[model samples]
Target: MGNSLAAIGARHQMWESTSDRLSSSSDSCGGPVVSFGQALRSAMETRDDPESLGTSSQDLADVDEQDVADSSRKSSVSAETAEKLCTIPREKGLDAQDFRCAMCRKTIGGSTFSKFETCAIDSKYYCTECMKSGGKVSIPARVVMDWDWRERAVSDRGRAWYEANQEKALINIKTTNSRLYAHAPALEETRKLREKLQLVSMYLFTCRESVSEDFRRRLWPKEYLRSEIDVYSFADLIDVKSGALQRRLNSLLKHSINHVMTCTLCKQKGFCCELCTVNEVIYPFNTESTHRCLVCFSAFHVECWRTSGDCPKCVRRQNFETRRAQVDDPHNTLLVLQP
Candidate 1:
């Protein structure tokens, strides 16, 4: 951009000098005067300006307008790069894939042997938490030194392992594609349903830890809480039906709800019933009570909500439903005639 600006200003200055010289000389030779462009070019050559002294009309004409434009574009790109990075990203040479996270160093791909637990933000090569808030934690100088030393110890491990297991990875990819193809007939309807929704899944943003923990006993049936339970593989052991799964999830979310997506009616930023009385005597549910409206995702106190089985806060949905059902009937079926 600086180069571009210099180039433009140089041309403008040359033009101004040319015009001034032409006008100044035209009065002296009124009958026969040199061409304004010629006088401008000659005047520019005589001037001490850096661009004017050696530059010719030919050089000015040959000035690549594209180059000047490209200079500005490059500057813009650099600015965009800085904005996205926000903070300087710690550089790495390792081909970090599903093995481990870049920030927290957690595993991305867990399976039976690996037991991968969560999803990765593939675009940024970061975990979701790392993407939300940059992983900037203070550490001791000694800890940093030790970590670097340990990392260096396994510097070429990723490359070496990938080289050796390239065939295995290829085979796994082929096997996955083949298995997915085999299930094409079964998953066709499911795929269509997902497409219809525009890929948006309305997941309950409730307490995940407590909900997952609640299913631990059912998963094991007999094993202790600390025992390593095969959750995905041995999920059938629990015999929880699909509807039961949704019900359990909702139940867990309702009871353990805290700072969920938001409170719908009150429009607060947490899992709370603002309408519920603060006093212990008035509010019998106390800290343990919670209610969730699956329709509108609103929650209120158990006692306050009562057995109404209707969302007190879903007036919008009710209006929408009413409008949708309102149709012109010749006999006036929906409304009673005033007559």
Candidate 2:
């Protein structure tokens, strides 16, 4: 078990490094590095910075350095708390010195240790006294992973803290807990549908036909699905499990398909199978039935493209170019053939 935890931690570190490089590349390309987590944080009220509390040296002199240090330490501890206990390595026994009520900073051990309850989302311990004063909340992790919205008990401070940040879109299960997708077939299915919806959205927005702004807003807010397809918030996951998001995606896709089939501008954007005599207009979104030519980028029936060894369009273009070169300069020592 220790080995497994170590391996997971190593992989997470590697992924973080890769993400850092990608972020740098995105910045270099002048694209905004607006991730799903960033969007969630932006929606919440800004946090107060301990150092920024004092504007001048006179104000700083009046402040107690010890208080600022304690606040900083507490903030760091809170931030280190994992959303799920499974993500971190843990032991069976609790140490009084190590464990404390996350809310009140009360030491949790001795006779009352067994009676203490844990927060489902943050996995923090709460003393019996704190638990008595707390309320119940639908654990965000349970809602996203299990589609379970049943309320669970937590300390009052925990409840208030959760309410302050519940709307913040922190967990992205696909990247964080990929094993869930394998075990939970429903989640994987929803993910695939969402990806297809992304493709459909691209087609609709890029087409010459003007899609209604209201419909776009209803489908997915610009903040959520801006330019990336994989980024999803807790709200999105919840909606998917509840069938609301899936229904919206289906409606939008149906509209897009109808527009493509009927509108002259949209139809013109489609490609025809050049490899076969059977003529049909195929869109890029139909990945199952059509294959695109590598060189000319024309769509063709899957079987027809596979049977033909090479792209017929490229062959014909090359032959025509060669013939034209001979006709233009028959006696030329060197003939330049266009590729």
**Highest TM-score model number:** 2
Worst 10 contiguous positions by lDDT, candidate 1: 225-234
Candidate 2: the clashing residue pairs are: 134-156
* Candidate 1, 1-339: lDDT as tens digits: 466546645755655454343221122222332222232233334333556346677776787989779978987865543232222234342344546655567555434322222211112244444444332221111111121111111112222332342222011112223343234332222223222111011121122444334534433342211121111111211122123433443343343333222423111222334345342211111223655454444445677678555654455445444543443233436444344
Candidate 2 lDDT tens digits, 40-64: 2222212133443336566666779
Q: Give the Cα lDDT of each candidate.
A: 0.33, 0.55
- How many pairs collide in each candidate, listed in order? 5, 1
Over all chains combined, what TM-score does candidate 2 have? 0.55
Error of 2 at 88 (Å): 5.8
Candidate 1: residue 63 Cα off by (Å)? 51
